[model samples]
Target chain A: MISVLNAGNWAEQYSTIGERAFLSITMTVVGIVIVVFVLTLLTVVVSLMSRLINGKPGGKETTAPKRQPEAAAEKAAVEPAGSSAEPGASASERASETDGALIAVITAAVSLALSDSSQPSAGFKIRRIRRV
Target chain B: MNSIVDFFNAFSETINRLWQGSGFTNIQLSQIGMILIAFVLLYLAIVKKFEPLLLLPIAFGMILTNMPMAGIINMNFYDPDFITSLGYPENTIFAYREVLNEGGLLDYIYLGIKLGIYPPLIFLGIGALTDFGPLLANPRSLLLGAAAQIGIFVAFIGALLLGFTPWEAASIGIIGGADGPTAIFVTKTLAPHLLGAVAVAAYAYMALVPVIQPPIMRALTTKKERGVVMEQLRPVSSTEKIIFPIAVTILVALIIPDALTLVGMLMLGNLLRESKVCERLVKTAGNELLNIVTIFLGVSVGATATASSFLTSRTLLIIGLGVIAFGFGTAAGVLLGKLMYRLSGGKVNPLIGSAGVSAVPMAARVSQKVGSDENPSNFLLMHAMGPNVAGVIGSAVAAGILLALLR
Candidate 1:
């Protein structure tokens, strides 16, 4: 195929169609490689910065687990005894703490069920005790 | 009888002046064609609302320039060989001198574009408005951005096969970058003649991002892939944000010196926004300064589309190639995104890959929209933004490489 446009009118760098084609391919390959390399370097830069500032890869984990406020509140309510139990605590002590937490949670749920949303402070009502 | 004869002569003289001085005598078929094209652009801008900020001004400037004998813009003054053809040594100042002495209103406004001032200033505004947190939180998105630039080089090769010189090919290829300013900047530097066609193609394609990108995104990814809910991006610290601009600027300076003007301005704006100390400057850069540059840039670029220059077979080729380049770019980004998805074990949503073409929040929004279509609960906007911002840097880098090599 013939060239559609002339090379630089003054310079006439590529007079032949074959040379233009070859140069075109070469230039394209070079451009893609460099673009990818530079951007990849930036990727590394951002990742390094994230690790340096937040002490993790990509800073995916923040300093606090404040992602879900409601979930955190629920966990706090359910794991009151577990929070106090250390790794060094005895198994019997841990079991007793767990039992105490379980009773408190059940009591709280009963109170909430008996209360009205407008009157949230209405205390627990022990109308009946039926073990299922 | 003598007084009546004098009155009739005066009336005849006045009619001759009006007929000769009006545009009607000077208008050519070519100018009429360009005016019609401008009207079409106006319809698209006003009614269809396709990048109205850019299209409206460009269409108006096109009308102004295409008006026969408007004398506002003289293309010969901007032609590279025009000065030399006039038996004078060619220099930019010399050209400006000619315009200053004999040029019109637009000839002065075009100075901003010819001197390559407007694009970098526009980049600064974009930097100020941008939030790099999405990109910073997910560094891998940078790869998708880089991958999207493959479209540029691919289009370069395609343009070469179509018989354009290397410089012309490079200018055309940048349309794939889908960055309007970068395309204009490269065209002005490498192939000023094609500036009109290339700018129109780039801006038109960018505005059509939503239309051009979705089908490709759907064809490449399965419903399951599109439906994948990406993990939330980690919070980027203010410190990281501050460091990012500095790091990118330094990197561009060290690696591609030609890119310094654009990348440097971009980083400076980002730094101003991130530092929070320069709130006053950031507000101005992001809003006032940007708006000013946009008007100048769009109008002057549009004015470059004179009848002879724009009504060429080459312009048609450029428009066709521009869309092809965009498709290639979108595909490359999506493919890389799919690669990341497989590597990350289904954690990464491949749809965000389409945003790597750098239409900014629009491309990101497209990712979100497509993903939402597949899974209503999935919101991919933030995730897509990571690649979207990276695409900005990637395109600038690609432009730098092209200018350095081609020039």
Candidate 2:
């Protein structure tokens, strides 16, 4: 058996098949375990930092809590000005009403601007308002 | 008449010398085979577009070095007479002067690689291009990146079992990191002799990430796990982005100073990009500077692959071990992802775990592809990017550990 404590020429010391195989296996296990430990430490650090800053643990639901208020405000704005419908009207109906009103206002504005310019406003229609 | 005869004799002698100088007469079967290998690399780079930026220059350099009497690289640094005549001790760390006196342009350019300048600079560029937002948003992915490094150690042991010396095995093992620059950097420092085969194996396997990773990812993960939709990452403040590199650098320097060269440069580049004040420097590092270093790094590394050095049983073993290491790394990562998947109550997609191999966007893309195949709405790209970028840091740290222990 080769002395593991020997600091001799590694090639010479670990020349035998048994020595080579044993050292390789030992090193492989040690290397992997160390890597995993280091990374796990990093994981804990990163997870802690993220939690501290974001005030949450993991995944997408964390963002939802932060965005809920903004979404509520948007929902209120998109609601009809004076509908007698219940507070829990289907979301799609409310969305359509908001869209129709938005389109009417946009069309009126465009028609007025085009009428002033004397360009043909007769055939014009706003099909979409892309947010580019 | 005597003058004419004298001129004819001189002309004949000149013609004979030129014939001898021609590469055709000096070319042997091995060198011819190397040239063919060079051509194949060129075809892969140009036609297949497999990491063309690096492979193209590498292939061209191979051709340049193989030509007879080009003297682009001197492989005779080990010759006892050559070492003795140069008045240097035998087996000096590197025969720099021998290369300067007898070597050609490529040999001079090769100094960047030998002295360890180019890889860090390339890392700087990589840092500039990388977005750590994904990593920062999901820090747990760091574990996946760490898990991927299992490939390196596995390969290291495999190389040892195959009769490679400790240093050589360590260098070969680093190929499992799936990081070209890190692999090159470690190989050059640990086993300069194995640089060519190791570098080729590293980059070629890196290019094959798309081919190599999917099967392993599938075998290790289930359809349901692949379809797991990770939540959108929380927004990271600009301050966190700026602090990340500084904190990482400080931590790495304190922990493993040997890795400071690679880790420091990578963090510096990241800091430049995140700071937003150094836009000019960031642009240069990411674009012009990176391009210049890559050309030199590729060609010089390729020039080292002469027929005698590259065509060896050890090279073959390194190549085989490299694949195994990569496979093992992918498996390890996915397995870890499975653990996370189970622990997270099916919230984490195991496919993103495969991104731990640090092949960057390539590994991340594989995760996205596999996930999308399972469920079209499942966008694992951003989640995968988290682990993918972490793998870079993980591999750099691993390289440092190996250097500290082995060197």
lDDT of 2 by residue, B55-117 (tens): 888888888888887777775653346667778886565576777677678768888987899
- Residue B188 lDDT in candidate 2: 87
lDDT per residue for candidate 1 within B288-374, as digits (tens), equals 999999999989999999988999999999998898889999999999999988988988899898898888888999999999999
* Model 1 Cα lDDT, one tens digit per residue, A1-132: 124334436226655777767777777778899998999899888888888888889835332335665556666667754564444335778776676777777878867766646665765544434446
Measured by TM-score, how close is model 1 to the native structure? 0.87
Docking class of 1: acceptable
**lDDT against true structure, model 2:** 0.85
Candidate 2 versus the native: TM-score? 0.87
Indicate the DockQ of the complex predicted as candidate 2.
0.31
Worst lDDT 10-window in candidate 1 chain B? B87-96
lDDT measured at residue B8 in model 1 versus the true structure, 0 to 100: 95
In angstroms, give how far residue B390 of model 1 lies from its true place.
Answer: 0.6
The regions of model 1 sitting more than 4 angstroms off are: A1-17, A59-132, B91-94
